[model samples]
Target: MQKKSLDAVLERLMTVFAVDSDSELARKLDVNRQTLGSWRSRQSIPYALCVNISEAEGVSLDWLLAGEGEMLRGGSISPTSKPAANPQEDAILALFRSLEETDRREIQSAAEEKKRIRDIEQRLEDLTEALAVARRPA
Candidate 1:
């Protein structure tokens, strides 16, 4: 199958979002900064990564990859609640929700590693508290 060219996708995304740098796009996509750099320089991105960014950012994949239509698939609609600082982030999250099992596993692995680090930090805090308690006057 013919893979979609990365430069085309990047250009469309840049135009749609009014962004100048891959870093900003990556931040919007919630992918590691380096990943965006790789996409920009190498002109390749994983399908999951593309989907991740597209969904999180609330971009239509058709527009993002092919430059076929409007930046917003549907026209502007008033948000009911305080909007996410980055509506695209909400799109990325929604994109993540639609991923396949294998793709989800990869994303989950990334998230789990971050969660594990947080858990370890919490445990360390608990230990520090216990040490403080032990040192308190009887």
Candidate 2:
């Protein structure tokens, strides 16, 4: 199998996250350090992982995966420094940041639950199509 090229994307991630090494990047991405090394070795990053990172970090999916357009989505601020344009949004973000670790985990869990539901819905659609094809009068 050919190793996929991800040098540009990885470089951009390191720069954007202000990380010096892949281990640091892995920590920021909430992945095991070995997983980062494995990705580097395989030269492939999972699309779902990319999506999760994009959503969690407020980064643009296109920018994260293909390095196109701006690093962040419209109206989304970078976690490091950029402030939200709306004062209310800034205040909400500040409150979120001030939450305890357990509260933060709960919020993350809710987001993950939404992602799980979407995945399940897609899987159901796929299965329904397969079932229809299986029952076709051929």
Return the top candidate by lDDT: 2
RMSD to truth, every model: 12.7, 12.6
User: Which lDDT tens digits does candidate 2 get at residues 1-138?
Assistant: 134348666765665565657888889888899988888788887888778778877888888777677767774556877654798878887887687534644565576779999999999999999999999999
Every candidate's lDDT: 0.67, 0.74
Q: On a 0 to 100 scale, what is the lDDT of residue 86 in model 1?
A: 86
- Cα error, candidate 1, residue 14 (Å): 2.8
Best by TM-score: 2
Clashing pairs in 2: none
Alpha-carbon TM-score of each model against the true structure:
0.40, 0.48
RMSD to the native, candidate 2? 12.6
Among all windows of 10 consecutive residues in model 1, the one with the lowest summed lDDT is 100-109
Residue 97 lDDT (model 2)? 68
Q: Candidate 2 — which residues are off by over 4 angstroms?
A: 1-4, 75-138
In model 1, pairs of residues that clash are 55-91, 55-92, 56-88, 56-91, 56-92, 56-93, 57-88, 57-92, 58-91
